[model samples]
Target: MKWRKEEQTPPPMEESAVPDTGWATTSMSTGAMANWTAVVRWSAWGLLLAGPLLGGWALASARTPVTVPTRAEAPRAQPASSDAVAPAGFAELYVAAYVKAGDSDADTEELSAYYPAARSMSWSGEGGAERAESASAVQVRQVSAGYWSVTVAARITSSSKNADSGRVRYFQVPVRAAGGRGASGWTAAALPAEVASPTSSKGVAPELSYGSAHAPLDSDPAVQTVRGFLAAYLTGGGELDRYLSPGTTLHAVRPAPYTAVSVTQIAEHGQGPAEGAEAQVPPDGVQRRLLVDVEGDGKHTGSRPMSYAIELRARDGRWEVAALEAAPALAAPGTKSNSEEGQGS
Candidate 1:
């Protein structure tokens, strides 16, 4: 296969009402009205003080409208756990693209501008000036209506800033898988606000190529088969593996060590990429997520590390990369804006 190589890289609320008493019933009258007067006077004071104070308290606790981000949220992608090795293909592609795009002098503002959800590429500086560092787990929390946990980590260096200023202020965020076993579908509600993009890319679909026979795995496959592929891709080396056919050895493993692949999410699945093609709908009426990851590696010997995807396809009873491309890695995730943005002692 022709490899396009490049290098470069809790809440609560309460309410109550005060009873009113007539002023006519006054205790000074030396009649039964005396107690009533006290009640009336006290009630008045209570109302006077309670109105604004109670109202303010209620307002404070009121639920505000969920402001949908002006720019869509970052697409949720689950970081494969250390033991959970993801399908090998796209990790390479994802990392490559991420780094190349991030490290270059190319106006990142444009990235923030062109795609609003892309604003996540900056680090506020809470990371502090690292005298030295290593790629540690960033954070994996729920962002949207999905079920997967996202992770943000970094492969740091011993310098003042990481990618910039040698402080190494960058985030490599990853989303966790949402769906349950025997169920290989997802929905918008299954994710956090961080990675879901409401907008769809128009015009051309990625002209991805699947190789021959054992190669170009058919996009049109049984749902069970697809699920198996995803499971394998996620686990790295496991049952029903993706990149492996028969006789494929573990040594074939290529570690994108410095590459930080964030949010490995599933895109979409259907009958199209294969012969008898059309949108492959889950009989149970579930949506299939398309998986993608972005990271970079400029150290690789090349002009610049170009990004490529290692997609999944089901062929001859197994899943494999349909197409192959080379790309750079992306900047790390959970990056802070300033020293105190998300800093913790």
Candidate 2:
């Protein structure tokens, strides 16, 4: 009974501002195109500026010199000398010929081979005769590269009535050498000059490590071993290896030059085994150095005396000869054996 008419209003119409919308889209596109153009221009300029610099750097690297390291080479060896033996021998022979010539003009022809300009020589006496027994070149020294001075020792015996027996004299000769050792050439530079003998120190006594007070008794195993070894070595009585240590090499004298040998004295470097301890076994790896004086009864000749510096080592409680020492050890200056002083006191 109360239905009134309901009315609905129409929806609003869409706006038609097409040009404004198109203008807004076109403006955004233009701005984006300008940004891309600026970026491309910057990249092109950057590449153009760097191109010449990179090319110049590459050219400079190609033109520059390069050094590679290498290893150094070793020096070559020099050839052997030729002047050693020939000049020394020639000088010795010349000295012998000079002594025989002895102030005579007729005998000068012998000297002509050596001196070439010799007419005569000088002598102290008028009517004495001198002869050379033996001559040997003892020393040779280089004055320069190829020049040498050879000293010859000559034994001269005079036939004069009151003159003494044969005497030793030294003469020096100058020589020049050329060519190789196989094919040699030599010339005498000057005549011989009589010089003084080489210096001597025979009066002085050498101090050795072995002392007189350290003599070991004959019963000691080391002393017995040395005695037995010497007997075999000199007279060929037994096998030398029986007393020799391991790795030791020795040979007995061939043909048995002697009939018997006796050990005269033995001087040990340190304290020896206790008295009557010879029967007991010594410690293994023990070592002792000894100076042994020996006399050999020769088969045909008289008794000959000799000395040996020896080393002995112990293994399995037995002593064996080790080595023949090259030289006896020396004692320091102002050092005296304490055992000697103890015995004296």
Q: Give the TM-score of each candidate.
A: 0.19, 0.57
Question: Residue 108 in model 2: shift from native, Å?
Answer: 6.7
Best by lDDT: 2
Cand. 2 Cα-lDDT: 0.76
lDDT of each: 0.36, 0.76
Off by over 4 Å in 1: 1-226, 236-243, 246-308, 312-314, 317-345
Tens-digit per-residue lDDT, 108-131, candidate 2: 766766776675445444322766
Residue pairs with backbone overlap in model 2: none
Q: What lDDT is reached at residue 11 by model 2? A: 82
lDDT of 1 at 277: 46
